[model samples]
Target: MFTTRPGRPPSWRRALVTGGAGFLGSHLCTRLLDAGTEVDCLDDLTTGRPGNVEHLAARPGFRFLHLDITDPCAPDAVTGPYDLVLHLAGPGAPADCRRRPLKSLDAAGLGTRTALGLADRDGARFLLVSSAEACDGRGDDGPPRSPWDDGHGDTADAPDPIGPLHTYAEAARFAEALVTAHAGARASNAGIVRLYPSYGPRMRTDDGRTLSTLIHHALAGAPLTVPGDGSRPLSVCYADDTAEGILLVAASRSVRPVDIGADPEPTVAEVARAVLGLTGSHAPLEFTDAPERRSGGPFDGRPDGRGPDTGFARELYGWVPKVSWREGLARTVTAVSGCPGPAPATTAGHGTGRWLP
Candidate 1:
């Protein structure tokens, strides 16, 4: 297991999260605050919405700053002499990554460099929230799926071409390399936590992410369209679980790559059904032929569905997910359905970042 740095949470024990106002980032902010650590949330509001963090707006220890990670002034704008920097400002979905390839690439690579530079300058620990996309896309193709088995043998009828499409994976790989190089150059303590598909409240219904899209479609009583056979196996993590894992690694000195996700991959159809059940929308099901398959879609870009090994689990900060997929889905359904009104409004002047929604 990786050890915590000596004299950790140093003078500037505050945490600066580059995308602190987004779905996952907001959750991370909550965790840090609950632990009594002051958190500075920086977001450009590109996808980070104010609603995701409305409850946290008034908290004394939480400060939100609207800015882009790619901006040179990001470090100055946040006023960070931070003890830790969690870089979660990259693209959120495959579609967006595909549609805005340049932005995605820049954010994943240059953005990472800037964040790590801030960490190095401030002498703070850095944790990069990476994607499982770096596993090389296109994992043995047979059929396209939502959650295909990562370790199935040939003739399994499941397809996972294990190569990333476009520059998304390349940028991720580049970012990882940058971190490793920077750490080695300065002997800095930096690491990466590669996350798989995760879903929960605060996810934008409008974004093209499958999880949110399915939930939105179900709630709207619209046809729940399965892109393919829906037999593709998928592993999803609850946002809270992902946040916990991130904290575990960020706080620990785990410098190696660690895979964090839920096991026993669920099929795309199952996810659709789950959403329908949760929302009580009884949405009709539909399947469309996905002819233009990306080189490396979700099914083939991640580690096998097998659980992490003991050594890896320990080295990744002894972190394990607490919430199950079913429980998480139920909780999210309730929360969204019970939303008092529209999500919280993005505020300014209090150091809160820009408002996207």
Candidate 2:
């Protein structure tokens, strides 16, 4: 049974999550429930597994509708206009996007448009979850940055329309634009959060994201694999931390971009080492200069410290990440290692398999 945190208790009656059964989306649903919000989960079970939300199926106030944002059906046609719509249903991992670039593009572009249309028609607030990749290749724009980067981190001497390092990055940019345009027109408030590397429970084990790669290796007591020089620094945010930021934007009146990440940037190598430490694994880490894993270039991995530094997050809404990296990782380790059980048989349309922790 999900319980509430200590407080007067926020009572947001109607909330909608686009990718409710995905890694981050599930957590968002949990957080919303804790805040006393009735959540409607919309997912088509494409990348999202039904098991991710099976636990919440019994919640009196929770409703799960199988609908893909990229291609919405009648059920997902907004049964009741939501008070707030948190759209987190795009391709987040690079590999996932690469595997199905078209679907990813559709989700980021058309999916965003659909969500915005729903919000506009319902007169609901919208909060789109963007990525730090939207900032620049370096992960963030930087504390002292150039205003001309267009948040996608302009490559040195690169052309004016900086080509995206990956299709997913481009899709996020498009989605943000879609949301922003809709917000300016209809919604009372809207904002986009450019999240850096976020790690926590519910992430799929097989996903090609860095944290998942490390955790899987550690779990198997195998050598952790490092791609390229392992010099790329990522502004990793804990899942709960990112969720808190998302919640803040959802409840806030301000409509702008917010960079959600942690300080003391950790290199990719450091991330692997941290996961090993958290897992109590003494396995050796094998660093390989895999060309496929190499960062596109200096511009691809640049980190920009923009967003929340402007005090937009705090000034508009009382939002702060309560969990530190170490604490967040510890919790993640526990959740990933200790689980409900093994997942059941999964098929494309069967919807029986649970999502990875």
Candidate 3:
């Protein structure tokens, strides 16, 4: 359990969220602030955009740090006696990893080490925001399962930690191992939450992922690009729900990895059609012969995973994704279609103590 107040939700006095300017990281930061937590959001801004969290700059309890976790000085920069430390820093989107393969490796390897060190110093409850891709590497055909494998007491063989895995999946496997080892060796309070695809507002439509790509073209009144006839099954959790599930795992004492994602398995074409309908775009679904490699799932190395059964989370923590795809997608459409976010007059950057607009 975390610190509790009379009327406010259970919260931490101060917390650190690495990759806070990122899509999911920003949501977690916002949710924490709403529950009365003083937040220090740290990001290198490599793939993360400052504009994502710039709106929170004026909030009294919020501070943004522009620092790379892999930097040796990064830990000292975040002088937090934090009660919660979330390691969400990494090249998460498929497009990001494909373009920045080496960066992806460091974010998981060195980045995880740096974040864990910060948490150990503060004795905070540490949570690594990982992806299901770390376990499910079936390319583009199969839906993603949780690392726990239905919690049937048996899990599939994890990707070889050595090699042969894609850049992102291999890095994820390495990060999870590092967290487990940290927990045993240092007695650090740590956990991992393996997320499936999570799409919603603040999600970059230009990421070249299936959902983002479809949304991007739909918003632009262009054809919704479909690869290989678009029959592969995929599912995504709403960003808010994913954030909440992550917080649940963070607040718990269990160090075991938990999966946080949706439960639907709609085909790719269905999802694209939904995007078109939501955007009110008359664009047709343009099927492409995007060549997919044997090992990589999609042509762009994007994995099309089936949704995992969230019963484990429901049983362990009373957590379940509340947003339906229709609703989640509609909300995403509204936000991406130029919905205004919080606009702070002036905000300060904690990393450099500089004034930001």
Candidate 4:
């Protein structure tokens, strides 16, 4: 639903996506290749699996580099005069962050620095796939407020940093600051994309996020579980839409953070029922005590506030989400149901199972 800016040639021809083996990252690689850009996908495989990108192995323009972005000489391995770099290499799932807090912090802090350095070195446009968690914390009550609402306008509106800096929320907030500082110093042409809930094909079954968990349960004919009162509202965007928004930001010259996702958010219970109907599973909906309930928590299963205000994206790039929740859920069910094994390690002709070191 968005068109490229007129009279300006698309700036990126050679691109690098830092988390290219993950669910959303893989979709991005596909989009970039479809646009004829040469893509170098960098993933450490800490949380990202190689099978997610196996389909892309055969594309002449696509290459996968297995390297941790936090290493001192990580950037040295990639040969680039790249036109764009998308930094998406951090742990986003709440469970993963909870299990490895330091790794999350380092990935956001050091990983972002590495990605920005690459962009600065190549004069490439840079984009950070930030989380909605970066927004100020909120309670599960009251009408949901948009990211651009009175109290949620910019990163400056984020909670005071004087307090303890742990947890994924704080880590992402710190990462955003790093990016803003880099841009302020005029080090790189950069933008930030704050993603809401995103789901689609190739989502890891054990990722422990709400949508994926429900789908996993439904497919197994197990009970779909909801935490708390199940009144929490969620605004989920399909993977393709999320990927498109990221690409739009990369192509734009804007430096402000843009919220990319859907609206008319659904409640957790609503989504659970929808999944059941789509999967034709007779599973009963069950409620259970949640391990922890924090706004934007992976298991929290709802937006902390109102859905994102995507007007900025629309005005800037003529972009908006095109997938309805019904259609999106149906597609996800089909994809997941058809997969007969662990994500295939290699597509027929894309490449060999062995990854590049």
Off by over 4 Å in 4: 1-3, 6-11, 136-165, 288-292, 295-303, 338-357
Model 2: CA > 4 A from native: 1-10, 72-77, 136-164, 227-233, 265-270, 289-310, 338-357
Q: What is the TM-score of each candidate against the true structure?
A: 0.79, 0.79, 0.84, 0.83
lDDT of 1 by residue, 43-144 (tens): 766667777777888887888777777766666666677888999886666755665677777888778988998888877889988777443223344322
- What's the candidate order when arranged by decreasing lDDT? 3, 4, 1, 2
- The Cα local distance difference test for each model comes to 0.68, 0.66, 0.76, 0.75
lDDT for 225 (candidate 4): 85
Which digits, one per residue and each the tens of the lDDT, describe model 2 over residues 199-314? 78877665566666678779889889776778765555778877887776666555767756665366778878888888999999887764432243222222343323524555
Q: Candidate 3, overall lDDT?
A: 0.76
Candidate 2 local lDDT, residue 10:
42
How would you encode candidate 4's per-residue C-alpha lDDT over 124-176 as one tens digit per residue?
Answer: 88998888755423324533333324554543334444333246667887788
Candidate 2 accuracy as lDDT: 0.66
Error at 339, model 3, angstroms: 8.0
- Residue-level lDDT of model 3, residues 1-357, one tens digit each, is 376433223588899999898889999999999988999998777777777888899999899887778777777778989989999887786567776788788989999998898888888999998877554333133333434453454656544444434676778878988999989999889998888888888887766567877888888888887878788667678998899888888887778778788875677899998888888999999888855533444422124444565666788777888888888989999888873332222222335734234
For model 1, the superposed segments whose C-alpha errors exceed 4 Å read 1-12, 135-164, 288-311, 314-316, 337-357
